[model samples]
Every structure is written in structure tokens, then in C-alpha cells.
Target chain A: MEQSFLAYLRGRTRNLPSVAVGIGDDAAVLNFPGTPEFPSTPESPATPDSADTPCLQQVACTDQIIDGVDFRSDSQPLASIGYKSIAINLSDIAAMGATPTAALVTLTLPSLNATEIAGEVYEGILEACAEFNVAVAGGDLSTYDGPLAISVTLLGTVTAPWLRTGAKEGDAIFVSGSLGGSLSGRHLRPIPRIELANRLRQHVNVNAAIDVSDGFSLDLDRMLASSRVGAELNIEQIPISDAAHAMSKDSNRSPLEHAWSDGEDFELIFTVDESDAAALEELSADDLSVNVTRVGSVVGRTGLWKRITGSKLERVFPQGYVHGETDE
Target chain B: MEQSFLAYLRGRTRNLPSVAVGIGDDAAVLNFPGTPEFPSTPESPATPDSADTPCLQQVACTDQIIDGVDFRSDSQPLASIGYKSIAINLSDIAAMGATPTAALVTLTLPSLNATEIAGEVYEGILEACAEFNVAVAGGDLSTYDGPLAISVTLLGTVTAPWLRTGAKEGDAIFVSGSLGGSLSGRHLRPIPRIELANRLRQHVNVNAAIDVSDGFSLDLDRMLASSRVGAELNIEQIPISDAAHAMSKDSNRSPLEHAWSDGEDFELIFTVDESDAAALEELSADDLSVNVTRVGSVVGRTGLWKRITGSKLERVFPQGYVHGETDE
Candidate 1:
């Protein structure tokens, strides 16, 4: 299916003049000449802004939530559903080291009190949009069978924003806040870290960046792949949420295991040059007010490894999520 | 719910920087800076021969599809559902006299689909994407308990694209092909007029443009509203489709009634100066190979009016297929 779809997509003829990179990439990058404010109507004349740069950079990202997979209707509130819908996309922009600017929401539902459901969903969306200062622009709504679902597309800006590549050998790796065990409350209400990312973009020269959505191990692999480098992690230094610790004992899974495989942490994992690592760590301690720990460093080897209690580093499996990869 | 949600969004924040137009507008406007087509993997940079334009222009539009209201899951294939979802958005870009470049799809579904459903859905998407040569950059997905609904956000570019207010008094209003009574097959598989838009944009200076998604009355009303002009239409001149005529008789609705408010036609309705209109019509007829007719002219009034058989003109209601609105 993926192959067929890709083949079909490759055949379309584009008519636009400023598409830059259209489809078939991790993110779509658009180039709009200068900054233009919103026109009141289609009739309003285009008033292009005179900036130093001829064109502005826009980054867009999208994610999906399913009935049984992403959330259960009975367990999740409509408001939480809406918030998380947009929150997840914002996290993607953060992964790109971009600041989220606005989002468009589309909904599918069954015949219920649409007015009431819209209110609940919008309430949650507005809450997050307000917190992030993202405008809820135009959207599409329709009815469907089965459980309720929401799809959010977030648009953001990047000024020297981090990318998956840009890492070099010997670069030090760090992460914002703690990792692992987010299935507790954090998973339900994960902070986007837009502010943190914005600050980091301003202060640090981040080599590579990715959000922890597909678990630390898998997401780290993506970051490394982009950077054309490998990485090593100290298992002892990995952070685990308090809830993960409590749940791990009963599940026979260690805290490290949860941190490495459990997804939806929404934390920023980034790399910095070795020389700037100490300075970044000190700056993080004093200014960022977040614990910046050195998990490991970029290695010449082209894969991921973890250092356990013993001296030897063991291969780590990516027990994380992959989109559209069905178990055939 | 819509009112409350709008209120919640309004209560948050002052103005932001990245967004030109925030909430409360028809569409969100943004300025993307430094948007270059970089390597997809940073390992495979694109070559210079890529035909895509490296600049960004404006992106504006709206989209919506409902179940029972838009499609029936039992009857509609997943592939068609996905195709129709994006087709509507591309139509909007065409209405603005722009070319579709990138698209963001949002889907809210009810139940879980095996790999088959995913394959079919993506299949439809890639079909549309390939046809338009537009990128499916990013989108969001979520679950709901309602009917299946899909919304798409399309980004496009305009080089001297027509505007709603560009219509001048005495400008001729022209429509592409036949309209009215799209309730049959066209509504389900309406073709987006992006190609026609591009062809006409170069030869004609369109004053104002719109796609007939709603009934001709309402959509025309919108065009008039934006141009701050009025329109006079010859009812007898409306090109009712054969499918519409068939449905009108089957449902006991007047052919004219179905043509006026049946919705989902996806045909381009545009206005041009009287002098340029003649030339455009000739050029479109000969070069574009499409029927371009003079359906009406811009008037001095603030609303829309149609000339009837007795040479009498009546005001158009501009009300179409409202989801829950009842006819008196």
C-alpha cells in the first residue's frame, strides 16, 4: 500500500510557483516571499512586507489519534482529546526546533449533540492554543461512524531551529527534564516545551534534536540516522517518572526499560559539541532551571548502544512506535 | 459550542509575531522565512534540476465533508473517501486563482481498520497528491464516535491570482462548464479545477473568483461580499447538469432548485471586466477547451439577484444546504 501510494503521489503535476519542497519528505518546507499579514478577505490586496530576507520559512507537521490505539472514548475526555491532538503536533515542531505559530483542526464524528461536543473539544483546543499562543484558524468538520477522532496540523517558524542531522562525532547528548514513565499524567497532558525549545534555539547551538514520541531508543535512532552518527547512553543516568517506577515493579519492567521504550514523554533530546557541553550543562543548571544530564556522546559506530552496570555496552532494541508499519 | 470555542480562543493572548492573521479571520495567514528545498534525509540533497519554485506565496481556503451529509461509509470506498477529502481543499485553492502546492489532511475516524483500510485511505490520498503534484507534507489523525469525517488544509501560490473584490461594475460573471444538480455523481467525485485556474490565470485578469461548493446563490453572494459589489444573474442561462436534472425529477425538487442549492458542484465561478471578459471567454473556449459563459454582471446592490422569465429580478437567498437548518 505504501509503495502504491508513493508511486501514485509521484505522478501528479504541480502548478504552483513557490512550492519548494512539495511532498515526500519528513516535513514540508514552504518559502513565502517576505512577511504578509492576513488579508481581510480574498479581495484584499497582497501587501508584501519588506524584510531583509526575501522569503520566510514555514514548517508544518501532523499526527493521528485512533480509537483503540491513541485513546479510548470511555477513558479520555473530549477536552483532553482536543488538547492532546494539538499538543502532539506542536511537539513535532519542537522536534524540528521550530516555534509553533498556529494550528488547523479537522474533526470526524457521529450524530450526537454536535454543538455540545464542539464546545468541549474547542474548549480543550483553545486552552492549549492559548497556552501556546497558537491561533485556531480554519478547520473542517464531518460525521463518521465508530469512536470520535481528531487530527491537528500545526504550523511553526524556525530561525536556526534544530534538525535531525547536524550532529558530529564526539558531540555530547542531553535531554530536557526527565525521560521515561510518561504513561502517567504526563502522557495525558504532555507539555509542548515550545518555550524551552525557543530558549534553547536562542542560547545553544543544538547539533541534532528530536522529541521523544516513539520512545527514547527509537527516536534517538532517528536523530542519529539524520546526523550520520551513532550514540551511547548511560542506563543509570536515564530519568524515570515517579509513576513509571511504581508501575514497573508490578509489571516486572525496570525504570530504565520504561524510559527507553515507553513513548509520549514529549521531552527534547538534543546534542551539542563536546567543547560546549560543559558550558551548556552549567547554563542549564543556572538559567534553564531544568536538569541537563549527559547521557552519552556521539560515536563513530552507526547505531545505538547502552552502557549497563558492567563496562560493556549492549545493543538496545527500539521497543517504540512506528507509523504505518503494520505487522504483516 | 462554536460560539463558546470562539470566545475561549478570543480571550487568550495579545497579537503574536509569526502569524499575520490570527484567529477570528476566515483563514490563518503566516509568513515562512528561509524556506529552501533541502535534502529529504540531509544525505540526499535535491539537485538544481528540480522544477519546483523555491519561493513561497500565500495559502488560503476552507474545507468540510460530513457523513450522510457528505458520504455514506457503507456505500463509499475508503479510497474515494480519502480522495474526496483532499479534492475539496484543492478546489478552494483553485477558487482563489492559486495553485495547490502542499496539503495537510486531518482525519477523525470511529473504528479501527486493519491494514486494508489504511492502505485504501492512503491510496486515495496519494492519488490526489500525485495528480496535483502537491506534497502531503503533514496532517493529524484522531478517533471519534461520530460518522467518518475528513478535513484538508491546502497551501498554494498565486501570481496575479484573481481576488473577490477585483470585480468592477459591468464586469462579466462567468462559470466553468455546467452547474446545478451536482447531487448525483459529481458531488461525490468532483474534480478540482486547479488546472483550469492555472490556464486561465495567465491569459485572463480575473477580478474575483470562487468555486461553487455551496449553492450558486450563496457562493455568488460571498464573491459579491468580498468585492463589495453586487451581481445580476440570468436564471435561464444557468447550465444545469444532466445528472442534476435526473435527481431533481427523482426527488420531486425543481431542476432550478437543485441547481441553486444542491451544493458540492466544485466548479469555478469568476468575474472579469466586460472588455477582458470577451477575450477571456474566447481564449478559454479555444485554448483551454472549456465552456466559459456570461451568467451575470456586477451590479450596484449589496446582494445577489437573478433575472427570471418575465424579465423580473428576484433576490437570491444565499442560503444553501445548512446542516441542521429547517426550511420554512
Candidate 2:
């Protein structure tokens, strides 16, 4: 079974130059074209040539998906499981504003129908890689008696990579796409904002960035804590998805609460200087692919808050999906 | 729990310059100092200055451990489980003859006292990282209803990485340390032959290399298949550990059979040009840290064989632990 899987991977990853040693070795050896310094922003939005342009540095992140916890194998297609596992890692790469290059997948499968399920899962993984233009260099496969688990470690290259701790007090906070209600099938098929992030970095000075995976409030809190800053959200200005609004119909929780609490939204939350906010808005309006919403602003205070209609501010608690604590 | 763990990681990796975004971010940003070309072999055995030397490429590998399968949490220490998980990944790096740089760990835990057990597991992981000088850049943690699992993805840099397909027909095969009886307590604490691999590469031209994770016969078969070569083993020259002999007393299998079939030795099996075999042997004898044995020679025939003292050759089956099929 491992041999067949390895053969499948070898066929998939065979002619990639960056992958010096692929499926047959104990590890994959990768070679990146060297550069003297970080490349400046291109004047036009043309695809960068790997042969001519040099990669300065690499960024890396890893994410995992577990059956029943992350998704239900009985309900979701194996391809979606594979796609989501890769997408979430790519989201982290997007947060860093890096161009994803390669990924290594590790799978732990149960004894039941291992090979066929593994083949389906790998097809899904390859689909995501093909969509994102990432090479599936190598991976490890093992059997477990428990539910299926997939872990993806992705590597990318970035010139001026965005950091979560780069935000300033005078910056305006913004988010790409609407937020919340991931339970309504959005969590299983997230489109990682990789291109949008790179475009944003090229167009405006993104001071800090993060992916809203553990809910908007908690992810924003993370960015603030890392940058040693605070944020004040305008409750009316926050964009809520239709899914969140629909989910809020049967409960006391409003769409706004759903926006703040529902996690697994693989959207980009970034900060830009107050002076560049207008330019960012104009760029967002011109770009039809993504809807950028200015939800809040970085505040001088040292804690998160929400401003009500009457200019009254209330402290916002860091409530979101915490692992081992949150049910979802 | 995730926040505390991230804080703990921050404290540990704060000083590493390569780790641009250590923790509290979606991903870790790594900055590798650029070089004009691959650095030539060092004149002496002194450690290469990272700032001065140019790393040509990076190597990556991933491995996973699941409770009750890879280890029994009830019988094994949490630290040992953590140690073995990291050790196996490092062994892959060692097989590439690369220096381990960073690691990303993903863990899924059951509902039983996860935080404390995770902390102990992390302590074990950090201990191994400190010993190997590999940084725990970042990781993901989640909860599950099934058994606990840990997957580690490791990154390393090497100028000239040894590949499994580099063996020549006339190359002499050598293995570091004794083989067999890994189930007799050695599997949990098998040492990665990182330093030994580097030393072997520096002193001699290693044609091909692999770590003995799936027994000598099976792993050697993997290398032979990749290299399009075969091997003839001098059964008398094969090194068997005392534990293998002790285990053989309880079974019909001979110590030699255990040496060939028992997996998870985590030792290195490599091929070098016949000219450098004597030099490698001399170097190994001088360095008491590792034991090097001349086990076999690469052959033209496309099959594995063991030569008996009476000039009779017996075919060796490539049998060992295989994931998904093997119980252990």
C-alpha cells in the first residue's frame, strides 16, 4: 500500500526542478534560486519568472485536520478533506504574504479500506496543489486504529513577508471577504486568499496580517497582542456573511455575534496605514475578485473594544474557537 | 492551552535569527542568508559559520506517531513518545546528510488530561531539539475523540545531500551501529545518526545512504531498487546487537535473522566507493561515538543475496515492518 502510494506521488511530482530529491529518498531535497536581495514590487502584475527572478527567503507553516473534529468523513468527500487540509496551510502562507512553493503531507489512516481512501485523499491533495500552483514534493503515510488525520506542512518564498507584529497605532484594520457561519459548508471548501494577499501587499503597505481561522475576534486579538496594539471595531461597519445571518435566525445571537464567534473562516485580516486607507478602498473597489471591508481601526488603548452607535466603547472579550475548549 | 504553548515556544526560540516570526503568527518567517554559489567542502572539520557559508538547498521530511500503534501511552513515557517522533524525522534528515534546522509539530489529543500530557510531550520534543540544535519554530494543536497523535515535519540544509539512487555497482556498503531488537526498548530511544552522517560525507564520498527504520534487508532493498543495483551480504560481517541475540532465545528466529528483519534501528546504511572504505573504517575506529561495519557490496544482479561460508548463496527476502500492513 505504501509502495503504491509512493509510486502515485512519484508520478505526480516527477519533473519539478525545485524538488531535487522527491518520493524515493528519506527526505526531499529542494533547491531555490538564490538572490542578492529581496526583489522589489513589480511595476506590472505579471507572473514572476522562477528562472530569472530570485527567491530571497522561505516561509513555512503546518496545519492538521482530524475526522469528526475538522470534518466528517461520512459526510464530506475525501477530496474536500484533502483540499481543506492544504487550504488552511495555504491560508497561513497567505497571512505571511508569501508565494507558496511546495507542500509535504502526512496521513494517518484507519485500517478499514486504507488504500482506496488514501488514493482519493491524495487526488484531493493534488487538486488543491494544482489549483494553488504548489508542488507536492513528498510525504509520509502510516496506519492508525483511530480516525483519519491529515497534516500539511507548506513552504513558500516571500520578499517582504508580512508579520503579525508589524501593526501601528495609526493603522486601519480591514478584512477580505465576509466572515462567520463556517458551519454552513464554508469550512469544508475554503479558498485561501493567497493571490489576494499578494496583490494587497503589492498595492498597499500591509503593516500586519493574519488569517481569520479561529473566529474574527480571536484572530484580531492575536494580531493586536503580537503588535502590542489595540483595535476598536465599529459594530455597524463589520460585514456579516449571509450564512451567518441565516444561522442567527433561530437563536438569540445576532448576525454580528455569529461574525465574531463562528470560526474556520479562511479570510485575510490585515492592517494598513491610516493615510493609505483611501487608496486601499479604491483598490478594493477596482478589484472585483475580493470584497475588502474596513471593519475597524487600530486604537491607542491597550485592549480590544467595540464602539456602539452613540460613541460609547465596550471592551470586547477574546472569545473564539480555542482548541480543546471549543466544541466546534 | 495553545497560547501558553506558543508563549513557551517564543521563550525558547527568541534568539534564533532565522526565525523571523517565531510564534503568535499564522506561520513562521524564515530568513536564509543568501549565497553566490554552493560553498566548497570545508578544509578542516571545524563547524561551518552559517553567516559565511552559503547553503545550496534545503531538505524536508515528515513522520507521525499514533497512540496504541506507534506507542502505548499506558506503557511508555510521554517524553519517550515525543522523543521518538522527533528522532525519526531527524533520522530522515540524517539520511540526506543534512543539518536539521527547524521543525513544525502537529498534535491531536483525546479528551483525557490532554494539556498536561501535551506539555510533557512538548518537553520531550524540546529536549531532542536542544540536543540536535533544531528549533521548534511552530506547530498546531487540536483536540479529538480518538487516540493522541503527533506529526513532525523537519527542515534542514545541505550542500550535497546523499540520495538513495547514487549507489554504483562497485560501491561498498557500510552501516553505522548494530541492528535488530528495536522492540526491546531501543525503538523508543534510537539515536539519529546526524553527526555520523556528516562526518562520513566529509571524510569519504558517500554514494548512497538511508536510515535503517524498516530493517536492513528492506531498507537496503529500497536503496538498491532506486539505484538500479543489487547487493551481496557477507552474513558473517553483519553486526547483530546483544538485544537481538537475547530476543532470539525466545523465538526460532536467529540473531542474524533479527539483524536482517527487525526494524527501527535508526542507524545509517550507506554506500561509498571501495577506495574510501578503509579510510572510513579507520575513522570509525578512532571515533568511539559510532560503530561502522562493512556489511555488503553492491552487485550487478538485481536481487539481494547472502553468501555462506561454504560458498553457497541464499536469496534474502526484503521483509520488515510496513505501514498499514504490519501490526507493529
Candidate 3:
């Protein structure tokens, strides 16, 4: 179904490549992905339990990426910028254990060759959408007097959503994949753990979850704070990525510090009860399609703690890419 | 149910007025308004035929408003800008003949006093959401090096969507509300005819519809072209707004020209069969809470025509605010 729609969309957007739509109308029509299609009326009702749309539990997330702030427009290609825009929102959906359904994109174009830029950007956007089977249902396109910016609102559904406020004292904290130095361009090609989270939910219960968009320690700290708990981490067990080790050579910070403080490492940080954690261990890393490591355990206290091999457990402060620091 | 949520939201956003959301969670959770409430799981699936959630058909529209282009940040209040952002999106939903369900707002803040600006802006955003009964479910807020930009994606549902391609020959075109000179500041306070369109749908079968976002003549011509027809407008019957007349005093154009050309009136221009047009005539102006006028008819010829009293039918060239004219 989506293949035909993609073909039609490809044909339609040949002239107006920013979005597959007609501005002649006031708004675009959207059918819920995996549900009955559009042109529905009062006499003809969409059916119940259409095998694909099992859970009507809708989840939504929105994020904006700017040209200069989020990425260097001069150095980075427009397509990569567009891909990152959609990817981050999908990552947010994965955090909630939701299967992404559709996206609404809005673009504010810079005062450059605006149409050419929009076409290039949306090329990557449509590519990502087709890859995920997410319909680019609707969007608003406009040229602005300033820098280019794109915001995407992704809608999805889940049988059971994992929130950031359900961690119990005995819950074991886990980090999926590795984290750190995503700013080295891996940030632009985020692999949202949509299938991994879905299959994991089928195996065991997830108490709380969050995507590490803004670094592992900071996001994990946020999850703990929301659940009204603290965590104690095993320093050696932290799955720092190779990028972190590479970054530590140039910067004074250690690889562990980069894992703790560098932002845009799109990975999953979640908590599961001890029994569910034990159940998760039985599945090989290949079974999950990603590496998962036991990082910490929820504690009763209210601050972050880390245990080192030959040193005592010590306090750690929350640090990451802090926003809202305006130059003015 | 929304009342309690509103109260909780109000209490929650006392300090953080930007969007009533937390940055801690990777994404915010959304319960479809009018559907069964949230925390829904696989075992507890949301039911079918919940009265308010009747329509399985989903519609979505997104619009982004920038500071210098759409509105003047210095003269206009941030609250009014916020209100207009959501209002324009709701206007698109209304044009689709759908009841709005939820909104996801994303803000790209400027470098100066970002937090205060976000707080003030969201004050009116929350106000508009409360008035429309649309949930402000989730949003992303970030400070950037450029001017303020707001993009709102509104989700809605309808039994049968009003399309711009359904009009037929001899159908009478009707417009709700007076038009033009919206650039005179009436553009800031857009009154989206959500209830009016709903009531109108009950009264007559609307053959086609388009919102006068750009202008009467331009949008009407676009609608007519999409329906594969032409329109002959009555020059004497053009319902000009007071703002247009006031603007005419200082400009070279007449009030009728302003009615035909100025943008952002946010009025509805629709078509119905001659029989349904007669049915609409029986409705009192008070019944719609806005003035409705028979302004034109779908013609067999393939261009816009204006027929003045005691004059021949004349061609009217399409002219309105043009976008994409960039400096670079």
C-alpha cells in the first residue's frame, strides 16, 4: 500500500518537492497509518481490530533542528540535516516504545536559493519516511528571512508505553547500544531502536525509559529524577562508544566523561525490575539486534553515584548540553 | 475531563509557562481527546464507538509563523503571536470540516531573554488551546541564534472531510465573514470558524471549501482550478470588511480590490449546489454567528470572472502576497 503511495508521492512532489501536497487546499487529509484509508463518511465506518492497528495508544513527539545551532549548514549537507530532523523525533517515539506512524513537517527556509534547498532537504526527509513506513501526511512550507529550520511532529502507537516515572527502587538500569561523541557526525544518522524496544517489551516489562539524546548520564539522571529516585552506576560497566575514546584523545576529558556529558548520542536508557532484568540477560545481544549492558541500579537517595574499581563510590553532578543560554 | 487537565496544566505551568511539559522525558504522552483516556495497554484496548470519538478519519495541518515575516515582534505582543500561531492551524482544521483534537507546538527561540519570551508566548498558546478544547500534548522548546519562530501541528478528526475538488458546474460559491485588509492588524486575531463550519455542514452539503488565508480571489481561483471549473464573482456582492475600507482611505486600491487581494482574512469560501445554496439562504445571519454571502458561481469557462452591475464579464488576474522571493 505504502509503495504505491510512495510512487504517487514521488510523482506528485516532482514539481513541489518540499512536501507531497497541494497548497491550493486549506489542509491535507491523513489516514491513520495501519488503519482504514481516507474518504470515510458517516454511512461507511472503519472497522474494529484491523490486524495492523491493534493498539490505539497514540504517542506524539516534536523537535526542531536549526541550521547553525544544531548543525553547521556550511559543512553539513541539507539531506543529512533533514534526516536528523526526522530521526530525533523517531528516537523520541522509540523512547516511549511506540511504533512510528506519521509525521507533520514544517520548514522555515533561509533567504538562499530557497526552493532548491527545500527540495534537497525534503529528499532526505522522504527517504527516511519511506524507510520507516511513516507517511509524510502533511506539512507547511515557507521561506523565511533567516536561517533554515525544520520541525517534525511524529505520531505513533504502542501497546504499552514506557514512561520516565515508573522506576522502582530495585529496578536495574540498562543502556542500549553505546553512547558518546555523536557530535562526530553519528548524530546525523540515528538508528532509532523501534524494533528492539518492541521485541524487548514482548519479553519483559520495562518500568521506565528515555532516549539518550542529550548524553547517557544526563538523560538517565533525568529519568531517575522523574521517578523520584537516584542511581548507583558501575564505572567499568559503562558501554562507551569508540567515538568517545577517539574524542578523549583531543579533549582533556576522559572517555567516561564524554559518555557522561556529550549530547546527541541517540540511544536508550531504561529501567526494568530485577526479574525482568534477569529475563533480559538470557537473550543474546544478537537477539536484541543491539548491545545492551547493565549500567546501574535505582537507589533510595537523591543524587547520582558511581562506583570505581579501586576507588570509593563518589558523587557525580548532572552535566550535558545545557540550553536556554542566550547570548543577549 | 479537560477541565481537570486544564487545572492540572495551569497548576503545573505556574513557573514554566512555555508548554506545560518537561524536558526530562524523551517525549510527552498524548491521550486522544474524545477517545478513551490514557494509560491504555494491550490488555486494556481503547473501545470502539466512544461517542465523541466517532470519526476514524484523521486530518492534520501545520503552519509556521516567523517574527519578521508573519508578524512584527517589536509591535506585536508575544501572547498575540502565540495565539495567531495556533489560530492559523485551527483555521486549516476548520477548513477541513474537522473537530480539532490536539496540537504539538515547537518553538525556536531567539538569543535574547529566551525563557521570558517563551513564557509570555505560551500564555496565549495555552489560552487558545483551552478555548478550542485542543490538548497541548507535547512540544520542543529551544533557544537559537536567530529570530523567534513557532510551528504548530494540529490533529483533527471528521466523518467526511470537505475537499476542494468536489465542486460542480452551477454550484453557488458562498463566503463566510467579510474579507480583506487583514494586514491592518485584524490578521493578528484570527477567528477560526470551527463551530460555524460544523453548523454549516449540518445545514447543507458543502460541495467544496477553501480558507481565505491568502485572499478571496487567489484562494477561490485555486479552488476553482482544482475542481476543474471557473468562477464568475459578483462585484457588487463582495462583502468588504471595515478594515479593508479603512485601509482603502490611505491606499490606492478600492475597498473591493482590498477585499479581493489582501491576505490573512482567515475566512471560508465554499461551494454548494444551487438547491443547497437556497437552503443556506433560509438561515438567519445570527444562526451562523457570522455573515454569509453568495459571492459567485462555478462557471464552464476556465478563468476568474468579475461581473459588475451594467458591465460585461471581465477577467481578473490573480494577485496576492507572494512568498519565496529571497534576497540571496
Candidate 4:
């Protein structure tokens, strides 16, 4: 079963030139066009004549989707499970402002109907890879007696990569798309802001960036903690999704609360200088494909806050997704 | 629980300078000292002035261990489960003839007693990382209702990598350490053969390599199929462990069968040019630490054969571990 699945993947990815050694090896070997911009050191310069000097900076990350927790194996389509697993990881690559190159997938399947389910899962994975222009370099497959789980490790290349710790105090906060209420299939069908991030970086300076996986407020808290800054968000200005409004109809929770709390949105939350913010807004207006919204501004204080009514700032508690915390 | 586990890992890996951004971000950033040997093509070379050219060929692989399938979480110690998960990935890196560098672990735990089990698992991961000089760069943690599953993605560096398709018809097949009877504690405590592979590569040209995860015959069959070669094995020359002998006592299967079929040995089986085989054997003689055994020679025929009594050649069937195949 593992062999057949690998053969399918290898047939699909054999055309990629960078994949020097793909499936059927101990590990996949790749040929990266090394960047000469970032030299190791003056004392230890990378001489082309030397046989040991590396020429490319490898960017790698891993993410996973579990059945019942992340998605329902029985209820949800396997293709979405496959797509979301890869998309979430690609979102990380986008967060780094990098161009995704390749990926290695690891799948753990249940004993019954494993092959059929794996085929559907890989179909979704290949579709996503095709959409993102990433090669399915290689992967490992196994079967267990438990529910299915999918984990993907994405590898990419970045020069002058954007980091979460690069934000400045006066930078304006921006999000790539509307947030909140991902349970309405948005979480399963996220477009990992890969191209949007690249285009934005080409036009404007992105000071810091992170993908919202653990809700807007929590992911924002991550960027703030990394940059040692705070934020003041205008609650009314946030781009709440239609799903958020619908989800909030029956509960006491406001759409704003859903926009701030519901996780797995997979949108890019970034900060830029006040001057670049206008340029980004102009770019967004010109190219309406990406919905870039300005929701807040970076503050010097050490905690997240929201402007409710008037100018009163209320401290926003860390209330987004925290794994193993069931008291939501 | 995720935060506390990440904090523990961050504290342990904070001192690694190569880790640019370790944890608490969308992804962990690493600074690989690019090798200068594989220079970029001059036509479109990575300019020193540009900020995007990568300088190193990053080697990455992901492997997984699931409860009930890979191990029984209720019976097996969590530490071994953790250690094996990392060691298997390290084995993949070693098979590439690359040095193990860093790793990102993705863990999916059950809803109950997740924290305590996670701590033990991470302790084992950290211990293995310390032993291998690998940094725990970052990881994702989640909880599910099913059994625990651990997936590790290991990143490494290689200037000139070894591939499974590099073997020629005249190459000699060599395996490190004794084989079979891995179920007798060896499977859970198997060494990754990282250093041994490095030392052997430095001494001899390893044409092709693979780690024995799915049994000796099956993995070798993969190398044979990849290299388009065949093999002639001397059955009596194969080293069978004591546990294999003990297990064969009550069964009709021979100890040699276990040597040929039992999986999870984690030993490296490599093909080297016949000219360098003597050198590797001499190195093993001098070191006494790495047990290098020459059990076969690459043949021109497209099928595996064994030398039986009276010097007769018998075709060997490809039999070993196949996922979900229960007819042992």
C-alpha cells in the first residue's frame, strides 16, 4: 500500500528538476540554487572552489491535521483533509515570505479501507500542490488501528525573509482576508496567502507577518510578543466574514467575538510602517484579488487592547485557541 | 499544555545560533552555513547584492510513529516511542549521507493525561537530539480522541549526497551491525547509524544507501529496483542475532529467516564499489565499533538469488514487511 501510494506520488512529481532524488530513496535529495547574498562570514567565506560550502538556505516546517479534532474523517471529504494539511503548512511558508518549493507528507491511516481513503487524501494533496506550484517531493505512509492523521513538512526558499519580530511600534496592522467562523468550510478551503504575500512584499515593506491559525487575537498576541510590542484594534473596523455573522445569530457572542476568537482562519496578519500601509492599501485597491484590511495599529504597551465605544481601550485577554485548554 | 511543552523545548534549544527564530512563531527559522562547492549557474547566478539567494542544500525528511501500529502506548514506554520516532528520521538523514542538524516534531495526543505523556515523550526527543547534536527548532501540538501519533521532520546538510540509484552492477552490498530479532528490545533501542555512515562515507564511496525499516529483503528490494540491479546473497554469511535464534526455537522458521525478514533493525544497508569494499572492511576491522558485514554482491540478473548448499543458486522471493499484509 505504501509502495503503490509512493509510486503514484513519484509519477506526479518526477518532472521537477530540483528533486534530484525523490521517492524510493532513504531520503529525497534536492538541488537548491544557493544564494550568494548572505555570506557565512568574512573569515569563512564560501568559495565556489571549496567542496564543502553550501549554496542554499533551507527553510523547513511541519504541521499536522488529526481526525475528530482537526476534521471529521467520516463526515468531511478526504480531499479537504489533504488540502488543509498542506495549506496550513504553506501558510507558514507564506508567513516567512518565502516561495514554497517542495513538501514531504506523512500519513497515518486506520486499518479498514486504508488504501481507498489514502487515495482520496493524496488526490486532495496533489490538487493543492498543483495549485501552489509545489512539488510533492517524497513522503512516508503507514497504517494504524486508530483514526487517520496527516502531517506535512513544507520546504521553501527565502531571501530577506519577513519575521514576526521585525514589527515597529508605529506600524499599522493588516490582515489578508476576512476572519472568524472558519467552521463553515473556510478552514478546510483556505488559500494560503503565498502569492499574495509575495506580491505585497514586492510592492510594500512587510515589517512582520504571521498566519492566523489560532484565531486573530491569539496569533496577533504571538506577533506582539515576538516584536515586544502591543496593538490597539478598532473592533468595528475588522473585516468579519458572513459566516461569523451567521454563527453569532443564535448565541450571545457577537460577530466581533467570533472574528477575534474562532481559529483556523489561515489568513495573513502583518504589520507595516505607516507610509507603506498606504502603498499596500493602494496595491489592494488596484488588485482586488486579495482583500487586505487595516484593522489596527501597533502600540508601545505590553498587552493587546480593543477600541470599543469612543476612545476607551479595553485589554483583550488571550482567549483564542490554546491546545489542551478545554475551558473555552 | 502546548505552551508549556514549547517553553521547555525553547529553553533547551535557545543556545543554538543556527536557530534564527526557534519557537512561538508561524515557523522556526534556521541559518545554515551554505556550502560553496555547488556554485549556482553563472547565467542566472545569485548575486551578492540580492537578498534572496540561498547558500545551502537543505536535506529534509519526515517519518512517523503511531500508537497501536508502531507501538502500544498503553504498554510501551512513551520515551521509547519518542526516541524511535526521531531515530527513524535520523536514519533517513544518515542514508542520505548527510549530517543530522535540526528537527520539528508534530504530536497528536489523546484528550486525557496528555500533558504528562507529552512531557515524557519530549524528554526522550530532547535526549536523542542532545545525543545527535540536533536542535529542537519547533513543532506543532494538538489533542485528539484517538491514540497518540508522533511525526518528526528532520533537516540536515549535504554537499554531495548518496542516492539509492547510484549503485552499479559490480557494487558490494554491506550492512552495519547484526540483523533480525529487533523485537527483543533492539527495535525500541536501535541506534540510528548516523556516525557510522559518516565515518564509512569518509573512508569509502557509498554508491547507494538505505536504512532497514521495513526488513532487510524488502528494503534491499527497493534499492535493487531503483538501481536496476540484482543481488546474490550468501545465506550462511549473514549475521543472525541471539534473539532470532531464541524466537526460532518454537517455530518452523529458521533464525536465518528472521535475519532476512524481521524489521525495525534501523541498521544501514549500503552498496559500495567492489574496489572500496575492502577499505570499508579494513576500517571496520580497525574501529571494532561499527560491524560491517559483506553479505552479497550486485549481480546482472534482475532477480535476487541465494547461494544454497552444494553451491547451487536459488531464486529468493521478495518477502519482508509490507504495511497491512498480515500473512507472515
Q: Name the candidate that leads on lDDT.
A: 2
RMSD of 1: 7.0
Clash count per candidate? 39, 0, 0, 16
TM-score of 1: 0.81
- The segments of candidate 3 whose C-alpha lies over 4 angstroms from its true place after superposition are A1-55, A307-313, A325-328, B1-55, B307-313, B325-328
Q: TM-score, each model?
A: 0.81, 0.82, 0.82, 0.82
Q: Model 4 reaches what TM-score against the true structure? A: 0.82
lDDT tens digits by residue: candidate 2, B1-328: 2223224434433233233323332112243333323222121112346445434456777788888877899999999999888999999889878777677778787766767677678778877877887666556777778888999988876665677878899899999889899899999988999889767766888888888987888888888877899999887888999999999999889999999989999888899999998787777444636889998899988779888668777888887876555432
Candidate 2: C-alpha lDDT: 0.74
**Each candidate's lDDT (Cα)?**
0.68, 0.74, 0.73, 0.73
Docking quality category of candidate 4 according to DockQ thresholds: incorrect
Q: lDDT of model 1 at residue A134? A: 80
Q: TM-score of the second chain in each model? A: 0.80, 0.82, 0.82, 0.82
lDDT of 1 by residue, A15-129 (tens): 3433444443334556443233222224323344433332335677766675566877677788888888888888888776776777777665544665566667777887898
Candidate 3 structure quality by residue, lDDT tens digits, A1-328: 2122223323422221111112111112123332343333563345565545533445667888888888878999889888889888888888877777677777788766776777678778877876776656556666667888888988776554677877889799998988788887699888888877877877888888888876788788878887889998886788899999999999999998999888998888899999989988888878887878998899988678987656667898878875543334
- lDDT of each residue in B32-129, candidate 3, tens digit only: 32235433355444566554543344566778888887888899999999999989988887877777867777778886777678777877787787
Candidate by candidate, in order, the iRMS in Å equals 6.7, 16.8, 18.6, 16.8
Candidate 2 regions exceeding 4 Å error are A1-55, A285-288, A308-312, A326-328, B1-55, B308-314, B326-328
DockQ of each: 0.26, 0.16, 0.20, 0.17
